[model samples]
Target: MVEAARILFGEHGFHGTGMAQIADASGIRVGQIYRDFESKEDIIAAMVAADLSDFLDEAVLAQAIAMGDRQRVRRWVLDLMIRKQQPNDSTLLPEILAEASRNPRVAAIMREGDQRIRRHVAAALAMLAPHAESACARCVEELMMTLMMGGCSRRMALVEGDWQFLEGCMARFLDQQIAWLADHDDGAAAADHADA
Candidate 1:
């Protein structure tokens, strides 16, 4: 039932899919779905959680944590964003975002996911950026997320691998973030940035 909802939601979106259709796709009775999930929203919420955990797991997050160099952190941020910005991911996320906008329940789930990622990013910054707490840290985090969310939507529908441009943009954004951080305190920034 959960798998059915993911595919249906991923394909037709939350608004377009019906419980009956999901049951049919999953080869389960509609009533059986209710036994597991209270409503479509519940199912979608689970899917969102699963997706978030699946995408940003401990292994990947650990690498981000182990990194401490400013230039390296910037490159790592871009590389991570590029990897997560697969075409289908951006396409599916907007539908979820739009659904979230109309439904408070959905919005809550989305916001939770966003908060989790933000905290993860912030922690990574703190480790590699002991001296960066002001605008520079926030800007780095925001730019990385923005590049991921925006680039996914913009480049998802393209053919022939257009994400290379997004990779370049991410690299540039990282460079800017590094320079901005360096200006605050180069020695401390460099020391934290060089974490192996």
Candidate 2:
């Protein structure tokens, strides 16, 4: 049902798609669909949860951190910032955002998903810079999220020109931020040792 909704939502905006359409696409009865999901918002929540699950495989980051692989951790953060979006995502995300502006339920769902992603980002930042202030991590997190979302908008807008150059610039920016975090944290650690 969620898959069907995703396709329909991508083709048509959130308000454009209907439960009957989802049921028809999924080959499920409308009653059965209702049994699983109360409304389109419910389906949206499930879709977001599934996407988050696929993206936030914590074990990968945990393993990298456990091995003290700073490079891997940095790569992980960089990948999150510049990950490729699925074709459907490019179509569907904007639709959802538009609907979210009018629907309180959808807005709440988006907020919760955003918070989950933010927490995951914060954890990755902390692993990269254990001594860095939370405020610093948060600033990095906000910037990364903005760039990520902006990339999605850029693709959706069908901007002309070479994307690789833009991607390279983004990667360099993130690399510098990560390096600053590492260097700043090291300095803070040394200061603590001196105080001790």
Candidate 3:
């Protein structure tokens, strides 16, 4: 039922999908579904939890970042994202995001996921830049998450052979960015610039 809900919600926006549609697709009775989940929101919540359990391994990500092999680690992460988007993730995510803007339940879920990633990124930054202030580390974490998330929607869609070009770019950019962060005391300059 959850899988059906994911597909239906992706195909038809959250508002467009009906509980009957999910029941029909999953071949589950509406009564049974209702017994399991109180509402459509609950089903979607379960779907998100299932996705997170299978999709992200924060420990592996942290280890990869700690190793400082930007090329390899970034590619590893990219490969995972691309693989996750295999059939229809790219489309599904955008649909959810659009719906989340209007739905408080969805919004809360998305925010929680975002904060989880932010915490992961902050941990990675702390591994790299030991001298970093918590505030500065947080700022870099947010920036990395923003840029990465913005690029992900399309990058996953184009999983061309080997992704060699993309790999090099990701490595070079990450290397430079990490070095810049290392040199800065607390991202104070970047923060200052953003204020203007």
Q: Between 1 and 3, whose TM-score is larger?
A: 1
RMSD vs true structure, all candidates: 5.5, 2.6, 5.4
Better of 2 and 3 by lDDT: 2
Residue-level lDDT of model 2, residues 74-166, one tens digit each, is 777776766767679878888889889999999999999899888878878888778776667778889988987787687788777477787
Residues 1-196 of candidate 1 have per-residue lDDT tens digits of: 7877777777888788999999999999988888988888898788878877776664665765675445555454565577655335645777888889899999999899888877776765655556764677888778777766665665565545656775787677666666676566646656778983
Worst 10 residues of 2 by lDDT: 178-187
lDDT of 3 by residue, 1-196 (tens): 8888888887887878888899999999999999999987787778777776566676677667768755545554444433334365766788778868899998998888777666666665665665666666667666677666756666546644555665566567656656766777556655867999
TM-score of each: 0.78, 0.88, 0.76
Candidate 3 error regions (>4 Å): 62-86, 155-163, 185-196
| Candidate 1 least-lDDT 10 residues | 67-76
Model 3 clash tally? 0
What is the Å distance of residue 96 in model 1 from its true position?
1.4
